[model samples]
Target: MIAPADHLTPDALERAQRHLVAKAIAEFAHERLISPERRDDGGWRLTVPLGDAEYLFDAVRAELDHWIVDEDSIRRLVRGTATDLDAQQLILELQPQLGLSDELLPLYLEEIASTLAGSMFKIAQGGPTADALADADADFQTVEAAMTEGHPGFVANNGRIGFGVSDHAAFAPEAGRPFRLVWTAARRSSSHLALGAGIDEEQLLSGELSAAERDRFATRLRDLGEDPADFHLLPVHPWQWENRVAITFAPDLARRDLVLIGESEDEYRAQQSVRTMFNTSHPHRHYVKTALAVQNMGFLRGLSPAYMRVTPAINDWVAELAAGDDTLRDAGFRVLRERASIGYTGDVYHRTAEPSAHRKMLAALWRESPVPLVSGSQRLATLASLLHRDGEGRSVVGALVRASGIPAAEWVRSALRAYLRPVVHCLLAHDLAFMPHGENLILILDEHVPTGVFMKDIGEEVALLSARTLPEDVRRIVSPVDDEEKALAIFTDVFDGVLRHLAGILHVDGVLPEIEFWRLVAETVDEHAAEHPHLDSLVDLRADSFAHSCLNRLQLRNTLRMVDLADQSSSLMYAGRLENPIGRARIPQPAARETVGG
Candidate 1:
């Protein structure tokens, strides 16, 4: 006879059987869907269906297979009234076909029977209740008895379900709500309990818990017979659990807000420094300005005293401009007066001599000056000095007339009248030859007393003839040849070297109009060549052109480099003086000779 219902009561055993049944059904359905077969005619076939139809059929098949005995085995086990054990044995015999062996037969049968009974109970009572079947009570009791035979520590809460642990105090919640019970079952002396929904895992793991709280939670979990490691909880917002845990526990997360609010004073200052450095002409100027501004703003910003010492150098051409050099001054003034006397005010007269009255006026200013006047040679030696000085450094009308270089005294007066009318015209028109500084030697002549006009500079004349107007081969040749060669050499040297140097110092990159600066230098040498054609013939004009071209390129490159250096130094000064004290001190010192030359 089958075992009576009075024999079963364990909940744990019942739950375990039910779990196994669900798993087995899932496995069976999966295998059926994947299994390949052959028909009697030797045609290959797979019974798997597509979509919802496949799932429905597979689930139904799995249920039937779990509950009913196969046709072949029914006769052996059903002699008279079949006992539960006899039924089980018959089920065991079919186990191998189902991929289950003798050792697994008991567990497999129990699981299948539990699932079927539970489903039937749920369906018969209502639609789909979670309540267990009343008919399976005896079966559950039998399974519980059998489970206890293999293990003594087990406790049954109900049916065939069970659990065991060393202690019951380990089920405490670290934070948030207590764990909610999902299911319960029992088998003999053991019980199984599944719980979910509790504290967040992040909150539990965060090291903010105090010593007492940590120990208390640990002890309580042990009492409840659960492993703390096995349970995972959700994380809680930091603000939600304040005093429960220290804020420092999550250093990375905690710093996010603080970092957002923190000021970047150092970075702000650095950017300002960089802006100031680039803004000024010289980097140091920016620094000095910044320092002064900072002090005015009541800050103790540092500034170097050496930066304050770079002033414009005194001009050295002042003495030559004085009337005390009377002969030279008179000659310059005479030339100006002759130009004024002529009707040549604008751009007419190309050649001339210096005048007197203009020279004396300029010379008087230079003689009284404490500092030397700054000027190019064209302005200083020829125009300023010649207008003012005489042979004994005394002014005289006769001497001025003679020095004007005209054969007749009347011509000097005419030139002066011609020259005076053009000063305003030249200044307004930017005429290259009739320039404001008298770099051009234009003379205008009139019928009577000549008005002294633009005074030409003798130094510029010398530079033009000597340095800028020399032939290339003459320039390349070593000094002190024959008189003719000497003259060519001197012209080349002065025109190429001295005049060009002055041009560079004055930043006269494109000032002259009649000739290119270097071409003017070549032309000066050519002028002297008329006296000695042989010396001129010795020069290779083609070679000289190429050489001057190279020199021009070199000079241009050097000028650009100097400009860049000036810009960079200005930037550095603005940023601040050198950090190193000794280096800062040395910044004002003259640059090393090699570096300056390079």
Candidate 2:
């Protein structure tokens, strides 16, 4: 048995705390929740206005006002004396400036410690060095499990609030353990199953389970004096079954409305998004994403049965859109459709709970895997891998660039063309936008060079801004945003949330300069605009600046539900304005190349 406290030594905890503190300082400062004054030694100093605590660090400001802090240079001082770098203490000292309410202070501190603990766990694991991960032999799932950073913008990105240390060791993505899922059979009357354009129950099940496995489940139901035909089978996270379902749904289990089935024969590894699991036993099989009641990031990570009802239809529509578009097809952009879903609704909670986590506990969806999409010598890596920095502080992207045997600028241009151009076209032509952050994208690489991208998380994150007509079942994706905020679908989500960090990584690693990075991005957008000049006015990419949508502020304001799914625009929190790097690159500067190269 693995000891949970083995990684909790003072050295590991201190290192993790320092790394998290650096991230908090950088992200909080970017969100304008804290101000760090520049010191004469080319460093930065942040002092609490209401307390005697102060912090000193060195960081370089990059595009979109990103703070590339040197984690080793961070130091904390209180009353003219040095103090241990504590992430929880940092939050407490900055509570007044953070605008955290009296009720939220304690919970926020807990999240901070949880994040720090996760960091400590990763440090203890010491899975792989950056160069080792970038080697040609590193497989797809290996990179996925080896990821250290959860999300680029969020400080408490790994706060799995409900998970104990043992649960963390078994289920967390960083744990990299393959485990089987618990299957349960819910009465057909109380459950719903939805399939995509060309899927059926038998066909989905045949691919998911072998004939013997299905027979085992059916025989188990028969032995319990229940007919298999009267129920639907759903796979659930093992932790949720032991902790939540067995205790909360005891009456349903007693009444035989929900029968406990056997575990899956195939094993799956957890993705960075904790609830989703990739089938390692059969790599070509569909990915299973189950409803996890655990609290992570800002909200309870639950899958609503209502959303499951329409998820496949929404995915089918998006798939059709991608297939029909010429530019998207030529760029080799693909959408991993949520082909099928099964949701179980327990009668007691469905009637009493008012659209909270209780109503969303027992649902799961199957997404397409990128394994079967590649052929020949092609390779697959999560887009998040490009942003990964190993324990030795070497970036995987730098290793990838070296392996590609291409100049850094040219390689970056290829990546932008493969990833960014398609996203731009989707927005300008169809007024369609998605949460295209790194974790949601799968990059198809040709020996370390990105040639295409596969976008997942379709049904949940897609936002359709056009007045285009849609099927009744697919209307759940028709999210209406204000005309002014429409551009933010690209600016805020892509540039600030994704590319800003990519640029910083490359710049910090000494691979590509920041100015050249944004210039290439602007060039890609310009080329797309030139092709369809009429659509250029739809999303004005040449704007001077855009609203600084603060992600950390959303969580700070309310950790329960950061944004309403039905109306996401209303919950946006903004600081001042962020100077658009693309707009800055568009200006006529003949000497800009010389400056970056020099």
Candidate 3:
């Protein structure tokens, strides 16, 4: 067994704190949460209201108001004396500026500490360098495990508050250890299972479990005085089963409404999204996503049972639409649909007035895995790996460009065609938009060049703003977004949320300049527009600027549930207008913009 405290070394903790502090400074500055004044030495200085506390760092003001701060150059000062670059302490120093309420300050601090600990764990593990991860021969899971950065935008991205050190070691995605899922049989009357088109319960079960394992679970149900035919089998995360279900639903277990079966025969590894698991033993099997009652990022990471009921239908609708569209099909884009889902209703939790963690504890969904989709020359990697940098500051994307033996500009263009082209087509042609962040995509690479992408987490993240007719069951995805803010699905979610970080990484790593990067993006959009002249005028890609929807601001206001998933538009927190890079790139330059940091 790995020691729980093995990774919590002093050196690792300090390094983690430094990197996190730099990220906090950069993101907070981008959101206009804090202003750092320019210094004579071409650096920036931020003096907080807290007694004699200030931060000094060298930074470049990139497009979209992104502050590309040098982590190594950061120095924390008090009374003109240097101190350790403590991330938690920096939060306290900037508490007044951050607009953290008295009630929310400590809770946010706990989350920061949790994020720091996760960073330390990753530092201690020290698996693969960015160069190795960039290789086409590297396994999909290896690249997933090597990723240290969670969400590039969110400072406290890894706040798994419910996890102890032991739980972190056993269940966190960074651990990358294979473990069997805890299986359970819930009485048919108290549970619901939804399957996608043409798939039956038997087919789902047979695919997930071997015949002997199925017989073992059925016999266990019989021994418990329950008929196997009268129950539905559910796979659960071991952490959730032990930490949440065992105690919270003890009554249901005693009443024989739910019975513990055996564990899964096939071992599974946790994906970047902690609740989701990939079948390592049987790579072709479906990915199982379980309800994890942990407070991570902005919400309690739980799958809703009510939402589960319509998941398959929503996925089915999206898949059929994608398959029939020639543009999307030609772009090599695919949606990894959630094929089946099962949720158990406990009697005690249903009595609550609102949807809480208790009510969301027992649901799980099986999404089609992207493993079998790749062939001989093709490999799978998380899109997040594109922004990854090793301890020595060598980037995975830079390594991939070198390995491909292609110019950085051409590689970026290929990436745009594979990733961004489909996204733009989906929005204009189909009136569909996905929350296509790094973690949500499986980037398909052929000999270190991006060929296509597999989009997952479909049921929760997809949005349909179209007025087109749809079946009643699939209407849940229809979001009534305002016309002006509609483009923000790409502008805010894609540009500021993802590409801004990638641009910074590429610029900093010396692979590509920020100006040329945005030029290629603008060129890609222009080319796509020329091809599809009958596109919807929902939002213009050539607009001067768009609303700056701030992620950290939402988290700062409500550390619990930042935004309701059902109506994401209503809860948006915006900073000011961000200058559109694409719009600027379209104009002929009188003078070339100088590269700042790189």
* TM-score (C-alpha, index-matched) for candidate 3: 0.97
lDDT of 3: 0.90
What is the RMSD, in Å, between candidate 2 and the native fold over all Cα? 3.7
Ranking by TM-score: 3, 2, 1
Between candidates 1 and 2, the one scoring higher on lDDT is 2
**lDDT, candidates in the order shown:** 0.22, 0.89, 0.90
Give, for candidate 3, the lowest lDDT window spanning 10 residues: 584-593
- Give TM per candidate: 0.15, 0.97, 0.97
Cα RMSD of all models vs. native, in order, equals: 49.7, 3.7, 4.4
lDDT of candidate 3 at residue 512, scale 0 to 100: 96
Candidate 2 — which residues are off by over 4 angstroms?
Answer: 1-3, 584-598
Worst 10 residues of 2 by lDDT: 586-595
